[model samples]
Target: MTEPSTKATPTTAERIRSAFARAGGAMLAVEGLEPAESPVHHLLDDGSFAITVPVDGAVAQLVVSAGQAGVQAVLEMTDYAPLPLREPVRSLVWVRGRLRDVPASEVSALLDLIAAEDPNPALLQVNSGNGDTDRDTRYALLRLEIDSVVVADSTGAESVGLSALLGARPDPFSAMESCWLQHMESAHREVVDRLASRLPVSLRRGRVRPLGLDRYGVQLRVEGDDGDHDVRLPFARPVDDISGLSQAIRVLMGCPFLNGLRARRL
Candidate 1:
């Protein structure tokens, strides 16, 4: 039987990439404009992204003022865990770049691409062509040319190059992690307890809760009076599918039988 490693598999780049893919909202700060809440932002392949702001909003106004030179901008995005674990924010991504207005002619094509990529409802509010032509035109799109990407999490802070971030992919299990972790917390408290048992005696004193999940393994948050600590319990191997995930988790729980039987059942 393969034993699980204590080491984490998701590197800084992977974590940042995954967090960017999962983030629904971001706080954007432009050189001349006040910091604005950008709930409608989409990450592109090259680490640039489209952010929608009110056409008359400060960001749009700044873009019009800055012209082709572009304005310096920094976008901050937080990655929250699926479970309501203490310190639920698993990671924060800060992207510093140059912000420029997407030309009027390209808005249609850009909107189409963003909608195809994420299909976020916020995009619907901006796409006036979707039977909402009569609705007031409120939003304008701006693009950010990423200069650097930084990620801060329990592991630590690291600056990832745009190339490295763009090269990395979100964890294969990231999409389903929420459902799986929610189920583990709500329906399988006993399983959490079993996993907690693997923690060091010192860490076991704190309240152990599911923090994050990835193809590499599960992360646990130990919350106590001292503070919160994150521990990664890696799988025997990286898992790509639900069945593989189940087997990896079972191995982490240290059940003798690895064949379909769950550790909890044993």
Candidate 2:
């Protein structure tokens, strides 16, 4: 049987959703309001998200006033490698949309739905009868109807439509990216060095380090006396499984064509 190709691009929505899901909290900004940090309480199916804020805060008041009319807002979230390294930020996802408040009666069901999928302790505190009696009145749950989504990383930034995002799945390696990158950084110096040999002569003089890894390829950060440069080494094909990933890495290490590509990019 022929192996299926794993080199599929993640939809803008999928990338945004993945980043949002991984982010502990997001920076939220309303068109006419100040930016605030809010924890993501839940992500709905329609590319929308639920976030909590103090009921008495300016954000709550603005959202309440907007009501069904919805207020224009933007949410920015980022993914970072857990390991301590220079430029650990892996990718950034930005979401722009209409924001509105969830009614008191609907909050319970919404919270329940989110809990069923991914239970968060924060969600419990605001659940109907769990924590403070005045929790309902003290906290506000706002939904963002995503209008557009964009994701940026070492590769580049691209905009994604809501429909494409909803249909695309995140790369299989998305969850494991940090762990593998960390492992390579900590234990696989030789491998990284060998890969660096494939870079153009101009970049070889710099100190090369593994920067990022995804299903599509591996990136390296070359630090030189002059400055730093990032170069991506694309695999012969994308790999979803560990074995395939290993094979792809071997191909990248052995391929001469990459030298030309790297030279062109420089």
Candidate 3:
């Protein structure tokens, strides 16, 4: 028997809904900046529906007016970034796989092996899709930025082009270990967890918390040796208004107390 007739191809909204369904994530189409207000339409499942189109504020309007200046992401050079690291707080998931005793502190080779395994167009897209000749150079630059970010994140800034490109100070905190932590939570998560477990101190979120400020510095409490001493990460307020974790790590590394802590941990 012949199959039943199907309707014409669904709308973009229908396709979007279907894609969300396959991914097991909810699809929320809000019209205004405030999700609750000015609801034009809502849909639980796939079908044609009207969407509220939020008016572009001055910022968005300016981006449209001037065009590409709004979107490109700079490398290690930029002072202000809307990148993931800019957030005041971040929940970092660093350990990817359950690491059985590797017998060495460095797993760089193993990570390289993983990288070698997945060398596909998807990987290229992950790195920097801007290599395509079809798109505008500006947009292409944006794609390269994203790709550069992922590579810098997966490998390391120095491993990618950022260290040379930006001549970035070895903020060590620049790695922040947060971006790589994403991989640790996925591909390297188990290994990271194993490493943490081996630490005399247990590692878990909220197990550590940033405490009160100390003399223009920030303090974090993690239960390890020294019985939860306030670990101060230094920060400097530059003439320019830029401040972040990089300052803290740079300060900690230079601290005599931290030098002792490093010696103890080693």
Best by TM-score: 1
Please provide TM-scores, in order, for all candidate models, with all chains considered together: 0.89, 0.78, 0.19
Model 3 RMSD, rounded to 1 decimal: 23.4
| Lowest-sum lDDT 10-residue window in model 2 | 257-266
Error of 3 at 251 (Å): 15
Give the higher-lDDT candidate: 2 or 3: 2
lDDT of each: 0.78, 0.71, 0.25
lDDT of 1 by residue, 17-57 (tens): 78877887888887656788787778787568788777667
Best by lDDT: 1
Across 174-201, the per-residue lDDT of candidate 3 in tens digits comes to: 2222343333234533333333332234
Ranking by TM-score: 1, 2, 3
lDDT of 1 at 87: 69
Sorted on lDDT, best first, the list reads 1, 2, 3
